[model samples]
Target: MNEQHPPGPAEAPGFWLDTPEHRQWLMSEAERQWTFFAASLRDGPGFFSLDTAGNPLSDDTQELHSTTRLIHAFALGQISGHAGADRIVEHGMAYLRDHHHDAEHGGYLWALRGDAIVDDRKLAYGHVFVLLAGASAKMAGHPDADALITDVSDILDKHYWEEDAGLFADEWNRDWTPFSTYRGMNANMHAVEALLTAYEATGQDVFLSRAGRILEFFTARIAPAENWRLPEHYSQDWEIDRSYAGNPMFRPAGTTPGHSFELGRLLLQFWDLSGRQDRNMPVTARHLIERALKDAWCAHGGLAYTLEFGGKVSASTRFWWPVTEAIGAVAALIKLDRQASDEQWYRKLWTFADTHFIDHIRGGWFPEIDNAGQVTSTIFKGKPDIYHSVQACLFPLTNGLSGHIDDLKHSEPVAMR
Candidate 1:
């Protein structure tokens, strides 16, 4: 007689994804997010941040991440065959190419106020998103995709990449002067994401090789020594910078578990793309993912913002992006293998999101809420981002655990999501 394993959630009788009700609900949420964000384009080809009432805020300053994220979001809409996705893609691409692109400096500018350049720093954090927008638009079949991809790829190779360190340098002044000796894992984490997306788009081994180097540096080498809670800051010599702290929201003092979740998911994607070459990788990814969930998941049914390097809660405030990123990470684990714990965490995080984060009327997630479940915004305000929450809903619907969303439109379609 064969020993039996208990049924995971996906293996249960009514746990089918192809069911009309399930598919419709998932796709509808994804579409709702897309439709809600389309309002940002009301001012034509520039950026518009939205307030809680779904009204565009007074700020006209556009950051590279914000613009590129919108282009990436709508590119997913086009990838999923959502109607009118092309309009937003075209709009965002035009703004990105025209205003954000530095004609004098060659790399994208850091920020813009209307047509004027404000803060022309060439940051790797921002440039990776440009590459992401390019890869996403390329996958979506946008006309300007190739040009964006080629330009950004060349910039990254020429300016950002460090061959000996096997990682990208952080920032530079407008005319390519050295801005700082600072290095960061946040930007490099997202670099893996954009590089993987580029590899998927162009089948370029160079992208894959560079992404692997970053992964190996952080995950395979650094993470194990740090007890799987990756550090956020680093010196020019790549030493851990525990004393460094800037931007409470972005570059917090201690390690960020949210980034661990993201890096874990990216590792899985890297493993998949490499045809599962290394047997040790999945274990490494799992350590990163589960360690984050264990360290950050609070009693309030949400995750804390950041944790100390020793696994203590450094910042107690909860934010929306961490939960969304964790959801994406868990969704990937479930896709890779429907392990019982992964399935349970998947359901648990979605429950928390539905209970606290999502705004049923407005269609996008509320940025933050207190432990009592009352809406709060001490740090984050408005519904400015369409990238994180939307992908949390969209990733589970895809067959592959990687960032690719084309599966929703092609390859053994379950529903036209």
Candidate 2:
């Protein structure tokens, strides 16, 4: 079904997220999540575990991705002047330096169970987040920020980057000897995000150049060729892998509409950061956002998890992340075009989120929901992390996309409670 907004009154001069009421609400919500996550911290190694109801679960293995994400989130908290945020950021940084990093292997191991390597593979997905965490930490004035950023950047350049391909390889063994031939847009998409943050943090030309190349490959070339239903899996040579489905949660089969929304917003950020030279960037971003909404929005309400390349729904399950990404995508589009339909989408998506995904009493978003908008645990359970939802609240309030949250100048003040 085609989703379009009916003609309505012109939206006010500024974005909704910049308004005092929304800013206050977003900050309050972010603080609530921060308090929830801060409660899960374990002291010895300073790592968090999988959590349910603001408490860590029985899983002892600390995931690199979630740990890095929490660090990044807390770093944002530091930027906002939230009390106790620095301690959380420092705790996460210590975990990354002392626990996650492989000094001999030259990159981070994927997961750890109490100093024993649970999964030692070096994944591009995990490493990109390391870059992001470093950037955020640096922005928040962490003492070891420069070292973390430099180490991750050098490691990425040395191990993962294919200088000729302008894209990253997927994974490698712990000692960095054997490499996986598999390639993926998911990793590269996140690489662009990290690269942009790196460039902003260090003012490096190479990071920006690499980001542009990746955007050109995925947003300019492949996405348009595939009619904006981006293919996720790829071969070593970057050929589409239609039948390969590796992990149900991370590397699922078919196109992820959530990713399309995320790429849409990232492309716009790149366009602005690159001085708006590439006219196709915003155009491609709009196409991606519109196509994702049209193809993936479940008739019952929220977005479906996955869709075939031909625009058919492959997984009808609705998850919280996609909707949050959609909110950011539409917000970016609204800033560019200020179309009434986009504004309608922005408001509509937040309404859907508040009605379904948010946990009013528990204080965090439900990670997964069914098509009927009922909470579900089929794919994820109990608020794994707060990265996506917090960003959805934060990004729209920024004055520009040049840097991390710490670099963003608040467009409006938080309303007095």
Task: For candidate 2, write residues 1-417 as lDDT tens digits.
Answer: 212222122354556655665556666666666767777578777565545577777677788998899899888888877678888899889989998999886889899887788899999999999999998888889999999999999999998999898999889999887677999999999999888888877888998899889988988889889998899999989999999897887999989999999888888888888899878778899999999999998877899888988999998888889999998888788767878788778877887887788776667788887656678798665678789988887777665554546444332323212
Please list the residue runs of candidate 2 whose C-alpha ends up more than 4 Å from where it truly belongs after superposition: 1-15, 404-417
Per-residue C-alpha lDDT of model 1 across residues 143-220, encoded as one tens digit per residue: 888999999999999999999999999999999999999999999999999999999888899999999999999999
Cα lDDT listed for each candidate = 0.85, 0.82
Q: Estimated TM-score per prediction?
A: 0.94, 0.93
Compared to the true structure, candidate 1 yields what TM-score?
A: 0.94
Candidate 2, residue 42: Cα displacement in angstroms equals 1.4
Task: Kindly report which residue pairs in candidate 1 clash with one another.
Answer: none
Total backbone clashes of candidate 2, pairs 3 or more residues apart or in separate chains: 0
Error of 1 at 64 (Å): 0.4
**RMSD vs true structure, all candidates:** 5.4, 4.4
